[model samples]
Target: MTVGFVAFHYPRPEDFDDFVARVHQIAGVLRSVPGCLSADCWITTDGDDAVVSTGQWESDAAFAASFAAVAAADVDVTFDERERRPRQIIKLASR
Candidate 1:
């Protein structure tokens, strides 16, 4: 089955542009991995500043492999939300 993940990132207003840039870079890295169907970023034009990133894989195993490759590559992205809050991650699969 096709699989994917979505993550919601909340960075202070001052860090918004930098955070978006880093997420785009990560998406670029994800696109290089085999079986990665898509990798992209999104943001809202209004409301509380937030960012979203998504990655889709051809299969469950492919999704896992993509994660492994991203981890192994160690994309240099370091921006933490205030008080070290973690980003929200949601897994996805086609029914």
Candidate 2:
């Protein structure tokens, strides 16, 4: 399986609600993509303003194709300009 991890940060606390709404839209789009196994969003409640998305796919190719579609549609913009949070992706290996 291929997995994707996305990170987001909102500098303004007032934008939390709006950020969640945007996350919902992104999750919906991911679910509609072919070969997407699952997609979920997580928010940190530890006084840190960050949101993360974890997505599972059938294979790396599946993730690439779906992500390309997302980028093409300009749906990957979830962070505010003031937020400097960095996004990272990792590939897991089975033992």
Candidate 3:
């Protein structure tokens, strides 16, 4: 089973670029972690003031450890202030 960590952020319009740049930096760090299958960031299409980041890990433990590393890095951003949650999802269904 794969694990996902979703982070939602509501950033000011003026801080959009900064937020994106910081996320890019964070993504680079995350990609280097072992067992990190994929990591992506998405913005809403309807001019919403939020961004969602999804990270897939090989296992639940891997996801937790990877995120711990990210938190320890303290990349000059306050992700803790954002809404974050871990979820387990079924990717496919058999008929």
The residue-by-residue lDDT of candidate 3 on 41-92, one tens digit each, is 7776777756666677888777777767788886755644332332222332
TM-score of each: 0.85, 0.73, 0.73
Model 3: residue 43 alpha-carbon error in angstroms? 1.4
Worst ten in a row by lDDT for model 3: 86-95
In candidate 2, where is summed lDDT lowest over 10 consecutive residues? 86-95
Q: What's the C-alpha lDDT at position 11 in model 3?
A: 62
What is candidate 2's lDDT per residue for 1-95, written digit by digit as tens? 45555545444567667666676677777777898887777888887877666677777777777777677675646544545455454544222
lDDT of 1 by residue, 1-95 (tens): 88899998888877778788888888988888889999999996789577899999999887887777777876855654531356888999988
Candidates 2 and 3, the one with greater TM-score: 3
- Pairs clashing within candidate 3: none
Error of 2 at 63 (Å): 0.4
Clashes of 1: 0
**Which candidate has the highest TM-score of all?**
1
Where model 3 places Cα greater than 4 Å from the true spot, the runs are 79-95
Model 1, residue pairs in steric clash: none
Listing every candidate in turn, what is its Cα RMSD in Å to the true structure after a full C-alpha superposition? 2.1, 2.7, 5.1
